[model samples]
Target: MAVDSYDFWLFDLDGTLVDAEWSYTRDVFDRVGDRLGRPFSDREAEVLWHGLGGARDDQLREWNIPPTEFWPVFHAEEDPQLRAEATYLHDDAAELIRSLHARDRPVGLVTHCQAFLTGPVLEHLDIRDWFDTVVCCTEELGWKPDPAPVRHAIRELGVEGEGTGVLAGDGANDVGAAWNAGLDSIHVERHDPAFRGQCVLGDYRITTFRDLGQ
Candidate 1:
């Protein structure tokens, strides 16, 4: 089905709708590396930054890095303002979200990006009001692929049992969350699936919103 076929819509933020500049991503990783006493190669930075390799913890473990040790430093090194300044919204994402909001459709955001960072990016992009509800995944609420956060956003949108809903994102975990929550999904591939080492399946898959046949 087309994007317009969904009664309600959910979105992922970083890499899906908005993304930070490469320089910003590089800087964050550089600082994280310094703190950990180990430097990350450009490829490692890219993979971790975009979650291109799938489960972040699993990826870290493969690199012999302890996730428990890596995450805190990683998050600590991110400067919200600088990251926001470096962030840009995808043009097709802009078109789709604005169109949905303009139509008063129930649109929500369910992202792994924490509240501190998510707030600044949305504000910087001036698109905060577009979503009827925004759900930032937390340790307590659980992360994507678990269905808790997606279900939380669905509850907040008050669209439960109203009609069909769908979540669109750029990661496998996003698709997993959608299916786990009993919602349709769209995988917007922002990078080469080869880089991720697997093709992320969804109810629909496209590289851009235009490909959704909206």
Candidate 2:
């Protein structure tokens, strides 16, 4: 099906819609390491970045870093401005959003990214205005792979039928969420062993929206 095939579109942020380099992953973990004196390894950072581990606290458990202690320092390393600057969107992403607008289809963003980061990144990318709803973890929608968030976004878009909507994301959770909600999924693969596609497979795999075909 083409990009315009669906009446309602639920998207994932971070890797799907935006090219969030998260250019600060290394720097953030480095700072976290300095404070904890545990030091983050490059491979460890990649694992974290890939969403391989459930949560940072869980991932740090092996390293013996206390969640209570590590969270504060890790969160502190989040540089909103730096993140805003580092995150960008694929050229075709903009075209996809505009095409959806022109088609008068309702689009909502359901992301694991909390609001503090999601808001600025969306604004910086200049595409927030295009979405009908943005459900992030910071809110009550819950995180991806659970399906509640995707289901919520579908409802927010007021979609009534099963095949009317589809979730397009780059993570296994994204695929799981769609499966839970009984909706289709499109996997936009950009990187391997990445939150971008890791074990989660999609109903449709496309490197870019154009792969949807005319």
Candidate 3:
């Protein structure tokens, strides 16, 4: 199948386009630990960050901090730093986006990450103009797996037709979100069991962006 066959492409930000997992976690844990008067190590940060998934409420529960207290502290400390360190992008990411755009394929970004976090990353990467629409959690529509945000992205891109839209992501929630939105999903995995059975649920599974053509 040709890439243009997909009228629009929806992508997850973190882990899919940008590598913010380490830096994001470090900041979140540092802020949470500071507010709780506890020590947060990098290792601990990893655990807590991965636990966040696409659910904000669950993350708050894991950190044992209310959103009110958590947001203030997190914004005060981690936000700026995360924005700074999120300059890096996956190899060939820019080329891929450019190619997609050249083909007149509308590209949209739907991330569970809030605007505060995605804003800096987008600026740092200097690819903000690449996307036709961005649906972040801060926008109030809803998060991934709910499908509302995904559907909103599709609507923004004005995509229509069977298999004309694909949601490319790196997690189970991404898969579920695409499924719920009635769009084909492409799971990107860097290693074995990157998504386990989750990848099986996707219409396509690729180890790299290049596989999209195959």
User: What's the lDDT for all of these models?
Assistant: 0.91, 0.76, 0.72
Candidate 1 clashes: the total is: 0
- Model 2 alpha-carbon drift over 4 Å, by segment: 52-70, 160-163, 193-198
Per-residue lDDT of model 2, residues 27-128, tens digit only: 888888888888778778766655555454466787687778976677678877788888878876778878888888888999877777888887786777
lDDT (Cα, tens digit) per residue for candidate 3, span 77-190: 666445657547888566678889888788999987667777777887788998999999654687778899998888787775434688888776788899998988887765
- Model 1: which ten-residue window has the lowest total lDDT? 96-105
- In angstroms, how far off is 121's CA in candidate 3? 1.7
Give one digit per residue, the lDDT tens place, for model 1 in 1-214. 6656889999999999998899999999989999999999998999988888888989999999999999899889988999899999999999998778776789999999999999999998899988889999988999889999999999999988889999999999999999999999999999888777788889889999878665
Q: In model 3, which residue pairs have backbone atoms overlapping below 3 Å? A: none
Model 3 regions lying over 4 Å from their true place = 21-24, 38-44, 47-56, 59-72, 160-163, 191-200
**How far is 189's C-alpha from truth in model 2 (Å)?**
1.4
Estimate candidate 2's alpha-carbon lDDT, on a 0 to 1 scale: 0.76
Clashes of each: 0, 0, 0
